[model samples]
Target: MKDTKDSWQDSWFDTCAALLTDPQNLRVWSVIVSLFGDLAQRPGDRLSGGALSRIIMPAGIKPEAIRVALHRLRKDGWIDSARQGRASAHFLTDYGRAQSAEVSPRIYTRAAAAPEAWHLLIAEDGAGQTALDDLLLAEEYFSIARNVALGAGPVPEDIDDDLLVFDASARTVPAWVRLRACPPELSEAAHGLLRDLSQADALLPRTPEAISPLQIATLRMLIVHRWRRVVLRQPDLPAAFFPADWPGPACRAAVFDLLDRLPRPALAELEAE
Candidate 1:
């Protein structure tokens, strides 16, 4: 940060961060989650406050914001901090690690997870509401209507309600259904990320080696953070299940392409600089 004015003029990191950081909507706590999940999810991995600031400050987050976020995360049992002599180091708690691990596959996978076996669950109009709500937590279930849920894989055996199940395949899904499957707001986020990915990709150094490890970490955090929001919210279904214009496939491709170019750096490399 000492030479930030000069670095801004010369570094690709600033321009890419500018393009990727949602200033109006930037959530420091979420950004920290993305950072820790990407670089320090391992049990013993930690990021010292000094290194944390170096990586995040370039994204325009103030140190006070990060401090408040760290405090909130600690209070919520998501992170633990300890004194490391003159500086402090922070790492995820077991609960935090579990949460991050839960979503790692969806966040990191290069290929989409589309399954062929489809099933349907139906509930009595007003009586089985609780069962349906619980089932929605699993990735396989998608609420197609008030009383119905379409899912992948075998039907569950544990529900207590008088629920009906159907093993079905869709020969034809209507446009309205597809639109309902992925609403307009989700579509806009996907397209926005794709556009930013292209912009950030263009801003990077011509050769991968030219970028420092911290710079790589900064950009990767932004890419993965934005992507996590989009991918985790969209329904887990086949590409054909969504609208023909859905940007899911294209955005996924662009994300992995840029992330592959900026391969994740080691915690040691990131902290050292």
Candidate 2:
């Protein structure tokens, strides 16, 4: 009986070690997730800062590490923080908690969608072919890509109603975009933007460009986001994810508008680049 118990203990320890070592698991993120899980299952609605720290402390992370991790998580929209006295009380966003609940075998798998508006798709060279660095880069890119697609401050006004499409096929990428509406004179604008995006210095640093490595990463994640949205919106969408939006063809129109807005050279360059 003593030998059997010892063997069980050893196995348990090994399993834990494996879980901690796996990069896909995002150990710090898991800590946040587990913390939220506990809160979710709690009899009360929220957790106190001290209670959260106590729960996280046993995981072998230091106080400073926890603080930094929490900050990053909140900044990235994974969690929310509320000032409660001297401590920042942390709570998981629906997105973060959903991400945390995924286990090893299911880490990259998509989850059921929560409430959200708009969807984006990214077509990468290979699916599920990325390292931890790539994953982190992709996360950052998605944030920026979201802004670019919606015509944020850093990007030019030309993309106001356009979707910024980044093609990552060569040394310098191009952001081929298409707009929702077009004036007859601007028919060639898509081709022009594509050309500009293909140029080496098309995008200035910290501004939306066609070839930013960050944009490449964003494309990868947006695909995941799009896939999730499709699944979520399917029930309400009648013609499937690709046949275009239901009732008339507004969804299809929007997609084509985006395509039309893409620079002519950029459109051709996608297959070649």
**Model 1 TM-score, all chains together:** 0.93
User: Which residue runs of candidate 1 sit more than 4 Å off their true CA positions?
Assistant: 1-11
Query: What tens-digit string does per-residue lDDT give for candidate 1 at 127-234?
Result: 787678777875557888888888877766775457788888878888878887889888888889999999888887777777889988888898889999898888
What's the C-alpha lDDT at position 176 in model 1? Answer: 78
> Candidate 2, residues 1-273: lDDT per residue as tens digits?
989856654444333323222122235654555445433422223445555554444334577877787778788887787877886556667776665554211222233222233333233334322332243243322221323321112332332132434432223222232112222223232223223223312222222342322222222222222222222222221122212212113322332233233212221122122
User: Ten consecutive residues with minimal summed lDDT in candidate 1?
Assistant: 5-14
Q: Which ten residues in a row have the lowest lDDT in candidate 2?
A: 236-245
Candidate 1 residue-pair clash tally: 0
lDDT of predicted model 1: 0.86
TM-score of each: 0.93, 0.29
Report RMSD for candidate 1.
Answer: 2.6
